[model samples]
Target chain A: MSADATQRAPQGRTLSAAPGSAGLARRAWPWLVAIVAALLLPWLFFDWSTHRHSGFALTMLSEIGLMAIFALSFNMQMGQAGLLSFGHAILFGLGGYCAAHTMNAVKAGAMWLPVELVPLVGGLGGLLFGVLFGYVATKQRATAFAMITMGLGELVAACALMFMGFFGGEGGISTDRVIGISLFGVSYSSSWQVYCLVVAWTAIAVLLMRLQTQTPLGRMANATRDNFERAQFVGYDPRMVRFCQFALSGFFAGIGGGLYAIVYEIVTFDTVAAAKSATALLAAYIGGAGGFFGPFLGTIVVVLLQSGVSLLSNAWLLYVGVLFIVMVMYAPGGLVGIIAQHAPIARAGRLRELIVPYVRILLPGAFSVFGFVLLVELASFTTIGAAQGKAFKIGPQAVDPATAFPWLLGAAALIGGGLWLRLEARGFRARWDALMADAKAKGVML
Target chain B: MEVFLVSLLNGLVYGMLLFMLASGLTLILSMMGVLNFAHASAYMLGAYFAFTISQYIGFWPALVLAPLLCGTIGAAIEMYGLRRVHRNGHIAELLFTFGLALIIEKVVQMTWGLIPVPYRIPAGLDFPLFTVYGTQFPAYRAFMLLISALMFGAIWLGLTRTRIGLVIQAALHHPEMVGALGHNVPRVFTTVFAAGTALAGLAGVIGGNYHVTEPAMAFTMGPIVFVVVVFGGLGSLTGCFIASLLMGLIQTFAVVLDYSVADLLKWFGFTVTSATPFHEVLTVPLPRIGALLPYVLLVLILVFRPRGLMGTRDT
Candidate 1:
């Protein structure tokens, strides 16, 4: 079945770069501006008028930055190499552990090292582990790779418990980030400081990863993802490409882990658990798997859901699950993909022409979303509410349990909105098909 | 010797229980080419459903009803959820199942709470069946063994003697040919998924009382079941059976044997003391090794033989 599926998929033919003169300066400006903006971000937070000028926001931002790097690293494997790993936390956690232990050793006067260099130790640690495991894992692709990674993850986690000197048994390791010498007399004591450091590293890593996508190695990895035999026939060793990608991914993941250690001031088994790995997978996929910044956008959205949504409902997991399912079924390319579908229309100066259809489709979509949220919130209020021994109260009155009005209304909205969406989708497709046919025929005349 | 015999018996019982679960899993994995991360979640639901139903009716009815309920649920999932996600690709299907497992875990917790419920062995099978070295083997264990053995026999008979079983066997080797022979492939997939989940549910019905019925039980058992499936080989039931028995014996004997590497070293005229650099590892007890053994076995299998023991193709 898989062999047939692979055969049916278009082989990795190079995509025609959108025909245009080289926009070297235009492409370079966004990254340059982003780097400068990242550098000034910490300082900007010091302004009193800014709402996010606080310790908590800075810490949250740091966490987001770190996780974004981790997600990008995961994208390298899943998006580029076509390996679906569920145990990426092995690399991330090992990186954190290595950094923490190194910090501890430095504190004990066993070694003298600056905190800036500590992340390198962590990166090297991840690199070593990845190479050792990736050697065996890279021999097999797809499901076998996933299985091997899972086994290695479990082994490492179990060993962490057995060996207290390394993993600290379960409590993990804690160390002060201020132990090592500060760069340029900047004391690395505050979350804001860590935020600046992480953003700087994240920007660099993203830049490096983007460049990698343009490299021969990256192209080979893409080919390998399409077909190992094809890659072999083309004289590129698929295993070597996979191994290199895996190790580089570990480097970035390790940096993310170091930031984790720096932010939380502690590292534990939870940091490297399979659940954490699953979260990375979720974020990368939710963002869109094809583009460079897909995981970055996904990270922001997921972290928001994790931080903000969890406060209102314990069923946040249910919502995320539903979102993932919807994405897989309807929007396999993710949020980026949904947006990308309209790109050509906008490029052809027909942007305004679709506004009516867009709003028409969006209204039903919004209604459906609202209805879905209502159901989730109501369910949460019932289950988690009932669990917490809280009653369903509205203002001064507790709602009667026997009434079916709320459920009926929600159901009506769901069914009605869903039907409206189907009707709108048909209209949208008809218009889109007409536009495409016009473009093709006109291009021939031109 | 008595302890050894008792542990061996216990291992055999555990192995049989695992066989009930792994056999179903191996079939579904091989035929459908999905790992079914939610298989253990389905097992968990079966136990909870049986517990709930037993309150309304009785244990006997629940033993029959819960599996039917689970089978229907499995068929619905395969038809609606899996088939939809199947279009995107295998990884997406896996992710969907993974999410489904997460949601099911949460659902079980929301419905049943976090505490382990009292799902006791039937009163008829509560007494001790045998005594060995002052250790009593409960009649419930014997009944479990009997049920599992009967299940194995029934499955074997069904596969060997039934037409559907013949189709399934042919599908294992020549899925395309089976389809060409007028078998509805999608219907077969749905049936296999339902049957596999039903088998898991059956195991849950019988084993829930023997183990604790809790929300966390699925997570605890899920990985071990995966280990069995992977270690056994992706496309082979006989390998699954042997792997299950091997794991069962390893886990059972690991708890039974009260020795460490230090003990072996002492027997070899090398007295290990606390001062040794490797004392932490050498002196660690055998029970701790139990948890690590499955992963060790997994790594070894993945590294040395990616295709597994009875696999026709690499998983």
Candidate 2:
């Protein structure tokens, strides 16, 4: 509890923050705002006439909550400890497996555990594996560390399929979530009840993670990341720092996995696959590894692109890959960095000045994106979509993939709009630089 | 004895193919200190390109042209993408390649759909080379081995006997000094990357038909190549070659020789049942765990010998 208070101290000490009572509210405001938003978000998607909620929206929100915790735990390694883990899903999948087994035990009347605390079981599972693997993986640093984790991940994923006893092989383990032993005697079965629990666990996990980041171990991890030799000189073992960070990150990841198992009621080898590990890396990196909230922000974008955009497009993976490449090349600091860049403009109260430039850029940007998507859809329709007997339709009309006209239009729009966006982008950069310089000169930004 | 000979021959062929990919990877790793994660993509692209090209000009032309095309693409990637990311750091460069891998897989899926393409052995090379315990070893396997052998000789000669190779060898260890000596190091980096990718492409051209040609081939091949690379120790081609062959033999023989830990224990007079602590592990046939051997080898090597069999530096 005291550790939590100490961590919250830094949250109230920013330059724009007020002192004393005002600072307390300022510190509390974002959490308050987030809590209210979390509560109100599902209502917006409610169908009043049906007297029911959008199951899809609720499920997606729950997914986002789980992935947010997972991705944030990943950030503790990638961003804080400077470890690029290619096999993080091992911890998560193990946690889910543990939780699923526990839930089954409870159902079979062999265990007396309440359903709400299953995530803790998952966390413990994750922590155990993290310790076991971290010892081997953290023996080396940088690229070697990455390779070891990759090897470990492959080993575990392969093991998951090979060993049917624990992992249940190809079929996977499933359990009934309604364990009938809730603290409040609530026999939780509905998606609403599960979603509420997800929200609460996400809050607790996020808070614990925030607190963990302020501890001496976290600081030492950072120190090692920046310069391990110097950290060694200062009497800290870089390897031990990395090991602890990896283990702790696993603990949090396991919590997320527990929630996943609870919500989905099953865990598969797919959970331990390289793709799942890549998800955490993608969410953390695309969100921004610099800030505490970056992974959460990234989780929303990634899950939206994954779960939401996937429903509409056959070429969603292509979009994700392209987005990742573009971000790595252009916005290495990620979406958080892009948003954070405007802090000076916001502080100077001149955010509106760039609105016109943004609008100007948006037009051609939309044009190019539309053109690209058209080409992608046309190609997709020619192949997989055609195989599935689906035609590419624009509103009431079906567009023939064999025709040259759509191709010509897509190519022309992509070329022309790309050139136009480039010109507009140049102008935007100039405007942004000028505004940023003015703000810096006026002492509105540092 | 006959089964062992056939497996050994098959393993040697497979190992040479792996070495072709690993050699290119080693070249780039030693030269630029950047692990090109998309090397497998290049291999996949080579197979696809060959499949498409063979439809137009026949297999012989495709065998020549596919690698060239792969080299050109590799050069372009190096010039436009990798050169820019080089300033950011090795991790960014690696991530950039990782992104390329994802994109290439999706593009291949989009272009060819998800099924395997018919990139088969040409009529000329489809004949059986010799009798191998009644299972005829196709002439295509021999051709793959021949090409890989030729590549090995050429690579060795180029590195040892040529002027550019010597410069590259120097740059492998001392890139800054090589640059200070007025060598255009970036051009050297580009050349090596192109050459390395071309080698992988060549391997793909031959190996694709020898195996299956599919969209997922890159991903399936990606990890094992990485295992070979790590097991060989980075920056050491010889280590890579030895490790590849060892992995090949291990994988090949693991399939043919099906025994379990339980069997081995039983041979030592220990009675075993499902009640054993690791019954799941012990009872499973070695063939069942064939997919896991290379990774297990890699992990054990990293834990026991980080430098691997014959590397100058630690992993």
Q: Which stretches of candidate 2 lie over 4 Å from their true place?
A: A1-25
The digit string of per-residue lDDT tens for model 2 on B1-315 reads: 899999999999999999999889987886787878899999999999999999999999999999999999999999999988888799889889988998898888889988999988899998898996788988888999899999999999999999899899898778999999999999999999999999899988998988999999998888788878878876678889998898889889999998988899998999778787988888889997898987787777777788777776676
Worst 10 residues of 2 chain A by lDDT: A1-10
Best by TM-score: 2
Which pairs, if any, clash in model 2? none
Q: How do the residues A1-446 of candidate 2 rate in per-residue lDDT, one tens digit apiece?
A: 33334334444577556557877786778787887798689999999999998999989999999999999999999999999989999999999999999999999999899888999999999999999999988888777788788889999999999999999999999888998899877677888888888988999999889888889999999999999899999998888899999999999999999999999999999999999998888888788888889989988988998888777667777887787888788888888988989877766567889999999999998989888888888887787888887767866787888989888888888888999999999999999999888777756573
Residue range with the least summed lDDT across 10 consecutive positions in model 1 chain A: A7-16
What DockQ does model 1 achieve? Answer: 0.58
Q: Show where candidate 1 strays beyond 4 Å.
A: A1-24, A35-52, A385-412, A436-446
Ten-residue segment with the worst summed lDDT in candidate 2 chain B?
B306-315
Error of 2 at A139 (Å): 1.0
